[model samples]
Target chain A: MKRKLTIFKIGGRVLEDEQALGAFLKAFSAWPELKLLVHGGGKKATQIADQLGFTPRMIEGRRITDEPALEVALMVYGGLYNKKIVALLQGLGVNAVGLSGADAGLILAQKRPAQTIDFGLVGDVVKIDSLRVHWFLETDLTPVFCALTHDGRGQMLNTNADTIATQLAISMSAVFPTELIFCFEKPGVLAQAQDESSVIPQLNAALYERYRQQKVITDGMIPKLDNAFDALRKGVQKVRITHFNQLKKGTHITLE
Target chain B: MKRKLTIFKIGGRVLEDEQALGAFLKAFSAWPELKLLVHGGGKKATQIADQLGFTPRMIEGRRITDEPALEVALMVYGGLYNKKIVALLQGLGVNAVGLSGADAGLILAQKRPAQTIDFGLVGDVVKIDSLRVHWFLETDLTPVFCALTHDGRGQMLNTNADTIATQLAISMSAVFPTELIFCFEKPGVLAQAQDESSVIPQLNAALYERYRQQKVITDGMIPKLDNAFDALRKGVQKVRITHFNQLKKGTHITLE
Candidate 1:
């Protein structure tokens, strides 16, 4: 039997609220297994960019991470938000270390090539130095990662937090029984979209495809589910999409 | 013989200039002994505070870190500058990890009590977790620390980078033969403040006192020398004040 490792990915909304984030962290600290946190940049980045007089560029609703935008992300995500979370966790008696993928080359990425739309400094995950991560875990330290990676050639790249969590889950599963949890504002993948209570209790690959065909799961959610299924296929023992408060009560993604 | 460890503390001026910082990091990376870095928040913090509409409060030439200022410090120092340095070092083939005193509780501090003038969230170093730092060194990870510490009760406090470097040197010296270097823009402590070339090759307690009596070594240089001497008395093997480029050609401090 392998050691159990639980990974949680929190979106930007929960981070923006002090009380909500504090409550969530309180719960996280009490978790009885090896855990890691990956967080997304909140609206604070956009606000800071505006203050700096840099207009954000977007193509087809996807953020375009130009040089200035990347700096905003670096400051808000990696600096302010990450450190705040680490301090809160420390106060809660959890030994937490904040990290960016560039630290110690923990995550190496390849810059996305410009095609129809060039994502300026965006990167796709190439490899994870799992051994180094394992060292942190074995040393009784919890890692809190922000949505930033590096090219290993001295450039920091903006990365997706959900994708990072999936990749980490897939990679660490080789050594431990890894479970990935995607925490958002919603209760779960709502079956009725309008009704928050109509969450699909158990979502398998077939059900996920059916929901996609039925247009129940579309847009941003498609990629999230795809990443979840990909993690399941790539040896992750379990994956779930749920609300930050209702951690155990969410849509559990299964291979079946 | 104890293994040698070199620690460098760089002030805001070097950090504010990209080219100068790049040059400094190039020299630092080529150093053969085990090493660490501590960095100060440059003018960027004040620039950010102004943009955010917060007036920086200072007393007796010391900046006071109110809540807003503390947030700015967290964003600029812990986030933007620290990550940038980590990525730059990674590019230079050094496995660098960015850190704050909060991360892993590596440095514990006490928030200064409010007296005549409340320094707001500023903290003074109380303890250094030397064993944990040694783990990073043993793991071959170079720590790049920003001037921030936590109260262990969840509050992050602004700190002085030079002081943190001195504390780290004093603590780590027990385990390794540690040397502390304070890198600034000047060549060295000048005998004539107007003459750049009149670098004091070596400084001792006696000469330092004489310079103080003559009022040549006044103001900022006084506290800096006091910290250096304190480290030497505590156990640090050697301490120097120099320009970032002229690491070997600085005013070496001596106890005699």
Candidate 2:
């Protein structure tokens, strides 16, 4: 039987970590089934922002990517962060190719103009043209996507990595049953923040809403889970959210 | 009679001037030929370098792009600059698509190891994969390439726009009898820098090297000529170097 394919969301931390990145890439390169990479650049973006004297702001847990921050974010996401991840994987002998949503006109966005509120440089993924991406895939290269996109007319915009992944998955679901496995700094969705014993095995729509009501899903973890469900609802059947430490050791998500 | 195919080299200055960009694109975008766009970002890159407190140094006429400067270069080339060019051309009703060399594994490179004549985030154009590029060309979408490239792993490196244009010309030489045109802020290559009337219409190998000897052809200009010669050497019959102001009629270069 063919191994099921998975899309792994490796954050900037893991991609930049020499040891971790090398190991992750080695495993990925070893896998026979198709795997897609969607990535974020929290670390590199922060570094460049600090150097440029731009203090980044966030709204609703999303980086408040205004103009200056957007400029720096472009440096981080598509340039610094994207290449670093691609290089590390290439070092591990993976045929890894890095990209931003703009390359090959891969992804397009309608400017997310400041709405009732503002998202600044952030964009809603309006369109996905996966042709060039398929070109890389056909050439036996695993695409490591940087979480950046283009406004339909030629502006680069900051977008959430999870959103990039989910959008890609939604489009991909038309061809194959795609799965997204989001690997992060923390273990699987915690029942209790500090207690390893209170592990939640599964989550369903009702339970997710209840958790949302209880405010347990207040931090960065909420968006990741929400993105997972969004992908599931859009047609992807499998999404595994687990800590990087538990990767390749047979980790699973508890969905109700 | 069919209009001769002209390779238009659009400079950053014209791209920065909104009205000029729109007008030029309105005219140039109408051409149906094998058009290659090569551009530079002096103003934006220099501005960001000034803001970041780094001495923007140009070695052998090429910007010495360490990590910080490389970040800035990317903002100008891949982010704001690339999109702006593509968007304006598209707005002019040209089926235009923008690309940074980093995308589609088109431009691959080798990162210089640390402390040993470090090229920073600079890359050599290894291969121009025509698969995706050809698709866009056939579909009537003009490709606007940003002067950025990748190592095919994950690093985005800054390259000269002129060099990219030369290589693309050479690559297309076999298929289309390519011509490389470099558009700059100046009227054209001059025997006298101040005299627009002194534009050199053509150059043979011996004469081209004389310009290189006097250092009048130093800096970015050298690569432009070298690439022109490279294209000719690799089977391209001609390369044109001119100013955007002259693009309506186009310029001519004859190498014998």
Candidate 3:
């Protein structure tokens, strides 16, 4: 039997609140199994960008990562927020190490080619250095990753946190019985878009597809659910979508 | 015979210029032995602080690490500068891992107590986890450290990069024949601060003290030279103060 590894991908909302983030980290530190954390950029990045006088470029509701935007991401996501999380975890006696995809060549990415839209420095995940990552786990070091990747050619690229989490879960499943959890503000994938109590506890691919067709699951959540189901198909043992506070209770995703 | 390790501490000035930093990292990558890097923050921190509306508080020519200043240090030193160097080194085919003192509990420090003046969040080095650092070296992972240490109680504190390098050299000397190099903009310690060509080939405690008494060596160089001589008094095998480019040619410091 393979060892158990729990990977949590926390959204920007959880990180934005100091009290919430502190409470979440405290609970996370107490977790007994091997664990890893991947965090998304909060509004702090946008706030810092505005302070730096870099107007965020958005095209058709999609964010564009130009030179200045990338700099903001580097400072906020890779540096400020990431290191803070590591320090807090260390304070809780978790022995945490902060990382970007570029560190130890843990994740390699390709610059997203400009087709219809030019997303300046955005990158798509190309590879995960699973061997090195496994070595870190074996040595009992917990890694906290921010949403940044690097092209092998000396350029840093902004990446989506959810996709990074899914990729990591898929890769590590080969060595461990990996469980991927997506923690956000919502309790889980809600049966009714507005009802918090109407969470569909067990979500499989077929049900997710039906909900997508019925327009029950729309907007930002569609892609996240898609990523979670994809991870299940790619050999990840289990997947959960839950609120940070309700870690064990939210939606459990299965392939069947 | 113990294995050889070369440790370099690059000052803020050397990191200020983009082209110079690129060239320096290129040269550092081509180095064919076990190596590590510790870096100081350049003027970027102050610039960011200005943008963020934090008035830097300095007393007696010493900068105070108040809450705002410490925040700036975390964003600049731990995030922006450290990760950039790590990405660039990775691009150059060196397996670089970026670190702060908080990462893996590598460096433990104590918050400087309030005396005549309270330095806010500034920390003095209390210990170096040389065993963990040696594991990184043995694993073929080159560490790139920013000038931030943490108190084990979960507070990240501002630390001096030169002191970090000196302490690391002293600790690692037990397992490796360590050479400590301080890289700055100037070629080496000079006879006259104004003349670039008056580079001192070798320096010892007696000569350094004589130069100090004559007022030839004054101000900032005093503490740095004192630290170098102190490291020599400890177990560090060799110490040199030189420019990033002229790594081989520098004012070598000796105990005699």
Candidate 4:
């Protein structure tokens, strides 16, 4: 039997609030099983970008990471936020190591080829080197990852946090039974758009299609759910969409 | 027999130049030995601090790392520069892991208390945890450390690279016979202030004291030489002050 590895991907909402981040980390540090945390870019990046006078360029609602924008991402995601969390976790007695894919070549990416729109310095995950990750995990160190990867040829690329979480889970599933948890502001996939109390307790592809037909899940939640199901298909033992506070009490997605 | 470990401390002059950095890394990569690198902060930190509109405060020619200044240091020193070098080294086929003292709790520091002037967010090294570092080195991963440390109480502090290098060498000397090399722009300790060819080939405590008395080695070089001698006394096998290119050639400092 393979050991269980829980990979938690937390979004900006929990990270931006000090109390919430502390609470979340306190609970995360208390868990005894091997785990990893992937975090998204927070408002601090955009705020710092604005302060630095670099207006962000977007195409089709996707951030176009220009040179200055990439600088902002590096400073915010890899520096301020990543180190802060690592320090906090250390304070809570969890030996945490902060990482970008570039650190130990843990994750290697390919620059997105230009097509209709030029996505400057964006990357798609091409390879996952789990050796260093395994070494870190086996030594009882929790790895906190930032959403940045590198092309093997020496370019740092901004990657999507959700995609990184999914890729890591899929790859590591070969070595360990992986549980992927996507934590965000909402409790779960809400049955009614604005009602937090209407979280769907369980979800799967067939039910997801019916919910799509019913106009229940739309916009940002759509891509999130798609990624969750894809992880389920890729041999990840379980996928949960939940709030940071409700880690165990979220919508559990499975192949029905 | 004790194994030999080389620790190289490189400054911004070499790191800022692409060709110089690449050459240095190429030479470093070809060497098959247990080695580590500690890098100093660059002007990029100041540039970003200016871009963010934070005027750095200085006292006695030392930077006062106020809250905003500390944030900028974390972003530039720990984030942009550290990861960029790690990626470049990876491109050179050297498996390098970038680290801040917060990562893996490698080094714990105490906040600097105010004497005459408050050096806000500055930390003095209190403890050096070499277990994780030893694990990385033993695993064939060259660890590249930045000049940021944590107080182990959720606060990140800006530290001096030379001091960090000294502390690391002193601490790790217990495990291996260590040689600490300080690499910078100058060829070596110059006999004549502006003459590049006036390299002091050998330096010891007596000669260093004579040079001090003659006012030949004053200012910034004094602290560097002090660190070199301190490391020499702390069981580090050797300490050399050299240019990155002259790694095998420059001034060799000794106690005898």
Best by DockQ: 1
lDDT string, candidate 2, B1-256, tens digits: 4323345667678877877667667667666665757677768678767876888767666557877687677666765666556655554556555566755556666665646466677777788876656655665657777787777665667777777777777776656656677776676677776777877776677887888788656666776677777777887766777766666433355566
Encode model 4's per-residue lDDT on B114-159: one tens digit a residue: 9998898999999988776787888888999999999998889999
What local lDDT does model 1 show for residue B255? 91
- Interface RMSD, per-candidate values to 1 decimal: 0.7, 4.0, 0.9, 0.8
Worst 10 residues of 4 chain B by lDDT: B24-33
Question: Where is model 2 more than 4 Å wrong at Cα?
Answer: A1-5, A15-19, A55-63, A113-116, A130-136, A139-141, A196-199, A213-216, A245-256, B1-28, B55-76, B83-103, B109-144, B148-158, B203-223, B248-250
Residue B194 of model 2: what lDDT? 71
Q: Model 1, range B177-215, lDDT digits (tens) per residue?
A: 999999999998999998999999999999999999999
* Tens digits of per-residue lDDT for model 3, A1-256: 5589999999889999988899889989998899999999989999988887889999887899998898788888887888889889999999899999999989999999999998889999999998888888888899999999999878889999999999999999998999999999999999998999999999988898898899989999988998998999999999999999888889999988
| Per-residue lDDT of candidate 4, residues A129-198 (tens digit) | 8766877898888999999999988788999999999999999888888999999888999999899999
Give per-residue CA lDDT, model 2, range A1-256, as digits (tens).
4334568887877866768766666776676677788888767678767877888787776567788887776666765556556655655567666666765566777667786667787778888876655555666768878787777674677888888988898777666667878877666777777776555667776777888899765677778778878888788868777666565532244355
lDDT of 3: 0.91
- Weakest lDDT window of 10 consecutive positions for candidate 2 chain A: A247-256
DockQ of each: 0.86, 0.32, 0.80, 0.81
Better of 1 and 4 by lDDT: 1
